[model samples]
Target: MTRMECRRSLSAPTGTENDTRISTHENESECNEIPQSKSYPVFKNIGTSQCLNASQEVSDTGQCCHPSLMGLANGHCSNVLEFFKDIPQDVRKCLVEFLSSGVTDDLEIHEGNFHHFFHVANHLNLRRLLQCCVEVYEKGDKTRIKEKIGMCECVHYLEQLVATAYRRETSVLWHEKDLDSDRKFQVLFLTKDKHARKQPVVVIDFARNFKIYKQDIEKADKVGVGFCACAFEQDGCPYIFVSGGEEKKKSQIWQYDVILDKWSKAGKMLHGRSRHLMVAVKDKIYLIGGQNVACIEEFDPISGKCVEIGSLPVAAWSSTYAVNNDTIYIFGGKNPAGCISTVQSFNCKTNRIARLGDLPCACSGSRAVVLGDFIFIATSEGHLIKFNPMDGSSELCALQPFIRRHFVMFVRNERIYITGGVRKSNDKGADENHLYKYTPETDTWSDVATLSTSLPVYTYCTVRYSGKCIIVPFEKFR
Candidate 1:
């Protein structure tokens, strides 16, 4: 209902900043300093009188020959108590206060401490501590901790550390014949320290056999036909936005959460559109030409509202378009005069549109995909036209084996994939569904796989998410 100007800020630090914010004491010794042999700390089990050596080499399995300071009689041996003394005095004091108070408000750690803390935990086999950090990082709620730290930094460090530790432990276990295959060893130490703080340890199961199988995926919740969809990720979750289709060219919007495998209503657009082009740049989704409309609208997913940004110089429908950098290139489409080969460019930063050169020929209902600086347009006549928007030069590169119209195309892993397009039948003389793959390096086209049903030929949208191709079919209108 109201127009809002979209702006982005660049206030965050460019490189790694302090995430933990743990106070540094002027009197405390350096964290990197190795303790002298004479000054090495002595660790003792809570109930045992004998002290354990700090430099005692822990087995690859973390089993200690002598009793551990945590009072484990014959379990995994760890020198965490000894290593705990090596941490900066300020850090040690904060940790002690944190443990004693049971309140995070007084204890503040920076994100920069994540790497150091993780390495220390791995060296000491502090499984509970690692799990606590993992939970805090995953939840992304700084308030859950007394002092806020960088959740992303902590989570990234923990993932890398865990993966590396898991690999190393597996390698050692595979080579050791004396270690029983049935023995359940904790790669991530879940044992509690003297403080009694314990958390669940994620065990690496080596006995289970993993297999990969190709199976048909269940259909997503039905949405209206003729709508356009775009894929993007936010807050570590993948989502697909479907908008402006059937239901009388409704402005209704819906979002599919890949993680939850559920669909929910997003806000409606300012104008109902079909056969439109939607491209996500940063946080905003740009809705381009559709249904004979020259007006362009910008939809903000965060605000759940669309605003009229600008208008196209020429009204067109079913035109092939692609975004390169901050500019959007619109190619051939049908206009009032019929099929038009006009090409135009819209600068997003300046909100201005300028005329580029026309295509080699009119290509209504064509699909355009951008790979690097080159824009490839697949036309209904089964022609693959490569055009450079910078110099306005166009050339016909390769021809498709089967002519197609109203098809979906996208680029993934540097290869172009096309599917669900109508093709002339060889025997029955009726239009059939077909799938194709094109590689830019060899400038060639090849047939990859086919679909079970021909419904995609009628109405469907394709998006690549999490290294997998997801095809969402539109519900047919009765």
Candidate 2:
């Protein structure tokens, strides 16, 4: 029911002055009361009257307006029309019908035709139609829309439309200028170049069709033997902290800024460690058992310092763990007596350790990931154990198809993905390059895809970045 008024000065041969006005309505029924029924009127100051023709071209810019006018000022033209040369005829008809009736009954917008509608409506200056297109874009699925629109295409146009329509910025599409939080969740696999000895962190945007290419991502700086890595967020920025590997005396912690894509020395762990586990709870990192060190240390990213919080009651190392409710669940690991089926819980709040129960078997080199209320442990013996932490009850969930040790386990979209492990055998296991997917709903496992390279056991770590699985491999991929 709202009407739009436009005023522009016009020069005529007789020096006559006049003003033109435009009226538009949300309801098409209002147009019936005008002198010309079902037709839009375009009145000019130069005593010219014309009916708005959607298909007619009235300007060199290929815009439609009063035929008598040489040009129209920005927003001064009553009717903004374009031929929609590239658009399909049905789509063109839909747009023209919307302009005439202001009804969207036949305006079917979807992923396939969104770009066409957006370009046509934007070019014609149809703000209402453009707003509709933006709404469709906003309500789309994040991963799907990202794949369709790409990361950079038409983002500014959408931004401008949102600003004009809503008077505020909208997070409709991700832009390079957006904050790190706006970026998509990514998975990173750190691999070393054999020739140059440089570590190139492989970034995986799993949501973008789960595509991986080594040449597409830039190379990270040369790093030492990285034992384990964990991602932590500090003051709204994301970072990956890598602990040194193998050298017993190597305690340097390298911090990788996810936003800046740069690496530098964050600090050193309290003790030189290898075959350790690093987990982030809240803002602090807990580094547990490495090599001969049985003490657990807490690292503060802000202070760049590590403090010995406590130590494991028994000698335990090479075990996989997961954190829930501020408690670290340590599964079976090796001791002076060899592999033990010990399931222990360490409370972060009280800094206390207690024995929960024994794992199904003495799993020395296994991987564990938490899906829901249960912790799924993939043992090197080809057994998948499901452990319920609430009552410390454990049972075998399923059998792994591949009997592999030193593998990486991660969860995405309520499903588990394991990649880059060494095949368990008597003669020093061989590296595995296949990625396997486990669906808990059906208790099934399937080999989905093969990785570009194999990720060895202690050489890689997994963390969730923005809720997406990120695998940080610290070894050279053969």
Candidate 3:
């Protein structure tokens, strides 16, 4: 799967209102009833309706605007708020009821009603209206609304609002596995930048697309989470491999169908092989070396078929492989007999394999990520090696704070965050608690923020999400 790019389709919200008004036909539907126009600003027949605009003062210029947008038009203040400007007494009560007295709603700096309202409020320096922007956006999921927001003085509005715990650079926070014990799921992820005015952090329900459902996190009777292979199918969403574990295990390859909210079992591998590593390249998932000297196999997700792809130089299992450009490069992994520092590369274009330089240490489970033209390999002995595939030349950088083997290193906002792995002194145990960020520009590692969410990295701990690295913490699953 290539990648799902975030397309900024939001149009700047305009202050102008639709001049093309529909005359009062007085039609009623669940959507809205007694739709009001300037001809009659107030309607007693309409039970309760929230007024989106507060422009009490009508400009005879016959120019209708989102009242907030008018602030940018003439920068003049008058008794413009007409009689109908207040969110209608009944509607006002409901809107107030929706808000937390202490929690002021903030808007996505550039989009939506509140985002624009906040902009006008800020231009006039009205602190109270500016605060309401937050809650309004949170009450509405931003990603879903990003495409509809009109671009209006969004930058100026963002400058004044308070910042929160949310990542300014992220447009979306993907919920990987939303399945309850009932075996349900929702999948997909995306992000955005800070200064850009965006929507509030509101939860969404994939079960009903376009309709939000409140799903309480359910407690499972018994969790059977274990080592599994992951690959992209259908579109770019990820699917898990429930087979390819130990032999004697009933053959099954369960894939989580995110959009449909279901699971599918693909055909089994030739035989079960535990502690095996999986990597997807050129639309096909390669079940690389594994325990029991398992043969490399190519899985066609479309057909649910597994075809053998020869074998690795060593009978290795659980090694890290990084996909760079058109090639999938395998780093160190423990061969069936022992841990090896061997390096191998498979070219997608040529469909052939070749060997590269040996890692400084014979470590398995560490991650190899391709950034720019360099592949950075970190090991269980706290060793960080930068290798170039073009000439097979490698340079060692300052090591990690602690040693880990099966951690996930992925890119976000152009920064690489390394999460979770195991160590040798700990045997098959891993304490992937420490998260590190490496800035290739500075060739430096800095500890940014750590996930308070506990993710255990046990013997079979592996993190993978289509188009991103697998992030986890240390754990002992016994």
Best-fitting candidate, scored by TM-score: 2
Let me know the TM-score candidate 1 reaches against the reference structure: 0.50
> 2 or 3: which has the higher lDDT?
2
| Candidate 2 residue lDDT tens string, 238-314 | 67887857633368788875533446788888788776778888878888886688888988888889999888876
Alpha-carbon local distance difference test for all models: 0.50, 0.57, 0.44
Ranking of predictions according to lDDT = 2, 1, 3
**Whose lDDT is greatest here?**
2
List residue ranges in candidate 3 displaced over 4 A: 1-226, 236-238, 247-251, 421-434, 458-478
Give the per-residue lDDT digits (tens) of candidate 1, residues 1-478.
0010000001111222222121122222321222223231121111111111221211123332112212211122233334454455565555544332323454344543443344343343333344444444445544443232233233344555344442222111122342332222111111122232322111111111100011121232233445666765554234677777554435877786532334677788888887677777667788888876788888888778999988888888777778888888988887778888889888888888887777888888787888878999988888898999779889887787677654566564477867545554434322333346688888988755443333223223332222111111110000
lDDT of 3 at 338: 77
Q: Which stretches of candidate 2 lie over 4 Å from their true place?
A: 1-169, 172-196, 215-226, 426-433, 450-478
* Per-residue lDDT of candidate 3, residues 77-179 (tens digit): 2211221132123322322222212123332233334433543343333333444554455556655433443454443333323343221211111222321
The deviation in Å at residue 104 for candidate 2 is: 26
What TM-score does candidate 3 reach? 0.50
Task: List runs of model 1 lying over 4 Å from the truth.
Answer: 1-223, 424-435, 448-478
